[model samples]
Target: MDVQIVHEIFFMASLIFFGGMVGGAIAQKFELPDVVLYLLVGILLGPYGMNVLNVANGSLTVKLILTVGTSFILYLGGREVKIRVIKRVWVTIFLLSTIGVLISTFIVGYTSHLLLGIPFSIALLLGAIISPTDPATLVPIFKQYKIKKKVAQTVSSESAFNDAVGSVLFFTFLNVITSGHLSLEHSFVLFLKDTSFGIGIGLLIGIFGTVLISQSDYGFLKNFSPIMSIFVAITSYLVAESLGGSGFMASFVSGMVCGNKVYIGMKCNLENRKVQETVNETTGLILRMMIFIVLGTMIDFNIIFNHFWINLFIIFIFMFVARPLTIFTSTLPDGRADWHWNEMLFMCWVRETGVMPAALTGMLMGMNIPYLSHIVGIAFMTIIITLLVQATTTNIVADKLGLIDK
Candidate 1:
């Protein structure tokens, strides 16, 4: 509306487009994940580095972009999930996403509280914030390395599911910490409602979307099928959120339904498939670039440096101790899916935090929670370390484990 605001918007858009193009290309040339390049570019141009692109942390615009961008990433991740695979391994995925997240959260939370002398509430909040693995970071590794199909699917699906779980947990704990009034019973009810309603809305819309695409064969309808899928994703997310549901879960389910059923129905139409893949990939790339770049801009070196040792300690514990404990415990029960030691180890190490944690940290900062700086510093460090360590080394791990395709 205001002239300055319009100019700022235009400037940010231009920077993201041109910067992403250059950074993405360079990352590909070096065989690195584009996320790394995007983040570095963000830091270089952002307030922390050059002060060239002054996007304020926790601003309304940043929050909106993150919300939409993360929803899109989750939807894309879900679309790649195969229903057949889920049926066979749903128990494993469920245990990994839910029980696994809880275990990681408590382990990290209790340790932080005891070691750092922070309140148990704040420590729990931190644990919840960083618990979920990011699908956006892992998708590239899976695609680039041609990792074993089952392993990739498990990781991707678990990432998507746990993001929703982690988000719900984060907000629940945030409310408990801030207000100190919510009962466990009430929180459980809220969790149930969020999950169930989200699934309901997603299934309904997904079915509607599938029918919409499948029953239409007009040239214009076929041409716009990809756009239509995106429309469904955004609409489903908004609708679910407005009704007090988990928008992330809803968008994921909608995308999964549309991708597997509706998209598959068009198998006979090669042109349609190509158009869908091209458009979806392009859109996903742009969103990821924008998200990571914005994430880079939010980092404050002062906070990170102030708590450097603790941050490093947290990352080490999360990667080496907490994650392994959760994965091993969750998969140990009888009748759970049996996985090889290599697969289990790979799963433990694939715990990279990404956009969701960044978004949650921004939201918490906006809330002005106590010990905010420490929480944010730990989160930022966890993200950087995990991406640097886990994401970059995924292919190597797969190769060592003989999980990479020949």
Candidate 2:
């Protein structure tokens, strides 16, 4: 590693830590999502503002930051998914995460091709890029504003699941777009094989983590209960990815099991639970800080301006048209969870584009994908607009929909 880059690694990390803490305070005071402010703080500190935090957009440094931040955020997002609640609405969650993403991809894809005159393949790439709702953004907002439990859990779980699926979908398209050798059969096989391996790894490791921290005679790591979940979280992701699985799903499932320790036979004593919450919250807050701020710092406004007006219009369609279409299509069919119109509507407005898209954008940039400027510009705008409009308005939307907890 270059000496200057090492200095940069330390310097940027310090800035994000201090800057994120201060921005967090501001978010709490004004009742804004922490991610929105973290992004602004980054913009203020980056090339566009102070010009001090000038890091190359697709440099190794940015990629490193995103990799750590993305997985950790997924870990935290997974913790939000309680298995008990999941059992009731698993059908709805499944449809929303899998089939819902597909619906969103085509809707936005065709719309992009028609309006921008891009090929359908490249346009679908855009759709896949922005397909998943961001758990990094959604998890915190739901945590801050108490919405109806079922609604919050469902949205949070969907974000985590779809993030994994969206990632698989993105790379699948990348192979087709770049290599020009498309195979539906191969794609289908890869999807199943990867997702299944991911789930298997997560459940297996999560069970181990749980047993290790249990109050049984064999529970050796009970004293290290606080960090055991972390162990499971990181270990599962690495193991799953190593074995050709979704690391995102691994982290999430591990989190889900660790969170509901009782489901996995771990006794949730008060002291243990308290310590786990503190560590999780602190870690999650910092990861959110690093991910979004780094993302904001990397937004090259010049690229974003190439199709500024049209990008805004496309994002507008994504949030209003495609999102609602997805929500209705996925959730309306599930007869298991008695659905309400307002709750479904609330789900529509809450899907913000954040970490995963930014992470995927970073990967795309590193690959020097065609239409680099256009795809990134649209993605950046999606992050900004969705965070501004949907994230900022989360409380009001939930309140209006009568979904906020009393």
Candidate 3:
């Protein structure tokens, strides 16, 4: 890369980071999730608003920022889903993330095909692209709100795990579109391959991380607990991807293991957990801000507005019809979870389309695939609409549903 490009990169990074901090401040003052403001800040600095930074969509810098930022955030999300709590709802979580994503994809796909006249395969691809709810968006909202434990954990955990399912389905369908083959058995095998390796690798690394820093006799590296968390996250993610697994799943699984050291039978005498937490908090903040800001800058208003009515109508079905059907169908059958209507309703309202979908669309941006512009437009619009509507109203809805913890 040339010096000018390098300089531009640093300059853009600085603006994004600084803008994030400011957005965070404003978010706090109004008691809102910071993601909304981070996106707005990005729009402010991006080509549409100020014509400041014309950072090309799917550029290396954009990809790199999103890749690193989302992985770390996902790891943090995994940490929040305690094994003890998850066990009670494991079946629900599993079905919700896996089968639930598939269900969602089909609902949105068929609905869009009939309504917008989009080709069935392309519509299915669109559904797959947006099926996974974003954990980066959820974790912060959970932290800010005091939703009931079961509801919160289920939603957050679903967001973390479904990214794997969503990705596999997207690729599988993409293959279908290109090659005109839809193999159910192949899809199942592919999903298994990615998740198994991802969780397997994560388990090994999480165990390794725990032993390295646990206050056990062998924990010579205990002093660097904070730094080790970073090492663990990045290593798990890269290793899983290297092995053709879901890197996001690996990161989340590793995070779960790291957070609950007792589950791993480690005598974590790490007295510096507080400091480790501080580091993670700061790091997550920076990442969350950058992810959304970059998403903001990537928007193409011309395409978005060109198909404004059709895209908006699709989003309407996406948020309401498809999501509710998917959630109720997935959750109601899990007799073990015995979900309350309100809790299920809260889960229904809280599925914010965010970083995962944004990243998937970004990956597709460079391709000359049919309906690519529509895909990009709808995906980004989903991000904006969900963040603005569902995310912002979370507290109010939680309070209304009486799902709040307090």
lDDT of each: 0.82, 0.84, 0.84
lDDT by residue (tens digit), candidate 1, 106-189: 888987887778888889899999999998888887999898887888889889889878887887787777777657787777
Clashes counted in candidate 1 amount to 0
Candidate 2 lDDT tens digits, 1-406: 5898788788988888888999999999999988999999989999899977776777877777776677777877777788888888999999988889999899888988888887887888889889999888887777778888999999999998888788778867876788776678877777787788888998899888888878877688877877886788888988998998877778877777777877656785678778888988888777778888888788889988887888888888888898998899888888889889998989988899898898888878667577777888888999988898889999998998898788
Task: Please state the error at residue 294 of candidate 3 in Å.
Answer: 0.6
Clashing pairs in 3: 215-268, 215-269
The C-alpha RMSD in Å for every predicted model, in order, reads: 2.3, 1.8, 1.9
Candidate 1 Cα misplacement greater than 4 A, ranges: 216-223, 262-270, 334-336
Tell me the tens digit of each residue's lDDT in model 3 across 281-311.
Answer: 8888888888899888888889889779988
